[model samples]
Target: MANRSWLPYSISGEIVRGFGRGSNELGFPTANYPSSVVDALPDSFECGIYYGWAKVNEYPVYPMVLSLGYNPFYNNTKKTMEIHILHNFSNDLYGSHMTVVMIGFLREEKSFKSTEDLIDAIEQDIAIAKEMLQKAECLRLKESFSYDL
Candidate 1:
């Protein structure tokens, strides 16, 4: 594995509205960050899928999968930071303050030939994230200062 020089990278911002496809089409709801938050990423932070821990406002920490890239499948013009928290919530969290500590990279973002392929890849990413987040080191990231919970 490559050295995790970016491990424990932290960022916090209010969740913003996205393209509205994560839940409507992909069955995964994602919390998006504003352009200012995305612009603050380090130059070395690669465009890829990552697994991490996230906290929304004062809510409990949860495992999460993040997509940091200009989504090729949708031909997005601007780079985006989209996070899918691995827990069910009864209400939309838009505008809620969220903090995340990225623990590990999962895979590079790619364009899919079809929406089904994209969904399949996202599902696999979710599975990989769930398994990886159970590791001792990753679990310990939940205690990092990035998250208030």
Candidate 2:
């Protein structure tokens, strides 16, 4: 299991451009923290899926599902912190400032046998995140998360 103490953590940074797979392949657009920000995380922090709330620029807080890992399924060579905000944006977010308050862990990162399986897992993760973030504790965190960025 990953170190839970490191979580319930908040981080703010610019969303940089990634490989463009999230939208082109998965149909879900994701925002990522720059490598400098991502590298600041503690070394023992294992990669996995997480649930929480996030704000993009001055936008309202939104439920989110995060995939922090090397993406074994995609054979990614570098680690990434990919956050999928559950909202449709009418504009590009390539350089937007985003903040996330992670409240809970969903599952360990795993490789799927096929793209269909991976998509299914992503859909499930979003559903679980939506439900979990609605809980009292998570709701409280969501309410407390600052939207200044």
Candidate 3:
């Protein structure tokens, strides 16, 4: 089990282009972080799906799900932090500075039986995250979010 001691860890980084799977294949667009942000995480941090709050370029905070791992499904060798913000945005997010406050862990990364299974898992993660972020404590994080952090 990952150390739950760092449940609300926060990190900031500029969005970068990923493997294009999120939007092109999975239908869920994600704002990816450069390797530096992923490298800065604590040694105890484990790869998994996490629900959190995120804001781009100091915009209003929104619920987010972060996939931090080697993405076994894609057989990726490099680790990544791919964040799927809950709200849809009209503008392209590449190069935008984003800050995320991880609030809770949902599940660890795993390969599915098929692409359909993977898509279903992602959809379920989003739904569970939306419900979890509605709580008073999680709401406080979103409500009190500031780029200053």
Candidate 4:
């Protein structure tokens, strides 16, 4: 089982730099976060699809699709945390502090070809995640069955 406690706390940080050739599809302008900022996160963080709310210092945002993974299609290099803010989330978070509130995990990260394909897959993931999140029974099941690992 994967440990998720590492990400227990909501974090506020800046986008210092970002890399890779995959973020373009999500309309996520890629940039890297400083080592200090990234390292501040827990060491045992679990990687997966996540839905979250982000408050950008410069702009407003709605629910954002957060992804943590190594892009296998582009030769897995470094792991990344990329977010695709929903419409009305346009703002420069590059040098500003943004707070991300993780709501739920969608799925383990994986790479797919074709921008359209990726977007379609994300749409489905988000739909399932939203439905699951809204159901108290489902959340109970998740907690009751969830293991610390």
Error (Å) of candidate 2 at residue 12 is 0.8
Global local distance difference test of model 2 = 0.88
Tens-digit lDDT track of model 1 for 1-149: 43458776888999999999999999999999999999988777788899898889878888999999989999899999999999998998999999888888888889999999999999999998999888887766676644444
- TM-score versus the correct structure, for each prediction: 0.92, 0.95, 0.95, 0.68
lDDT of 4 by residue, 1-149 (tens): 46666443455677665664435546445434555655565667777777755556645444556776665555556766766665443444567666666666777776777776777877887677566555675454335323211
Scored against the true structure, residue 7 in model 1 reaches a CA lDDT of: 74
Per-candidate Cα RMSD to the true structure, in Å, reads 2.4, 1.5, 1.4, 6.6
Per-residue lDDT of 149 in model 2: 40
Residue-wise C-alpha lDDT for candidate 3, range 1-149, written one tens digit per residue: 55768888889889999989899888999999999889888888988999999999857888999999998988999889999999999999999999999999999999988989999999999999999999999988877776355
For each candidate, the alpha-carbon lDDT, in order, equals 0.89, 0.88, 0.91, 0.60
Q: Model 2: per-residue lDDT, tens digit, 39-130?
A: 99888776899989899888899999999989999889898999999999999998888989888899988899998899999999999888
> For residue 127, what is the lDDT in candidate 1?
94
lDDT of 4 at 71: 54
Clashing pairs in 2: none
Give the range of the ten consecutive residues with the poorest summed lDDT in model 4.
140-149
How many residue pairs clash in model 4? Answer: 4
Instruction: List candidate 4 stretches off by more than 4 Å.
Output: 6-8, 20-32, 58-61, 89-91, 129-149
Which 10-residue span in candidate 1 carries the lowest summed lDDT? 140-149
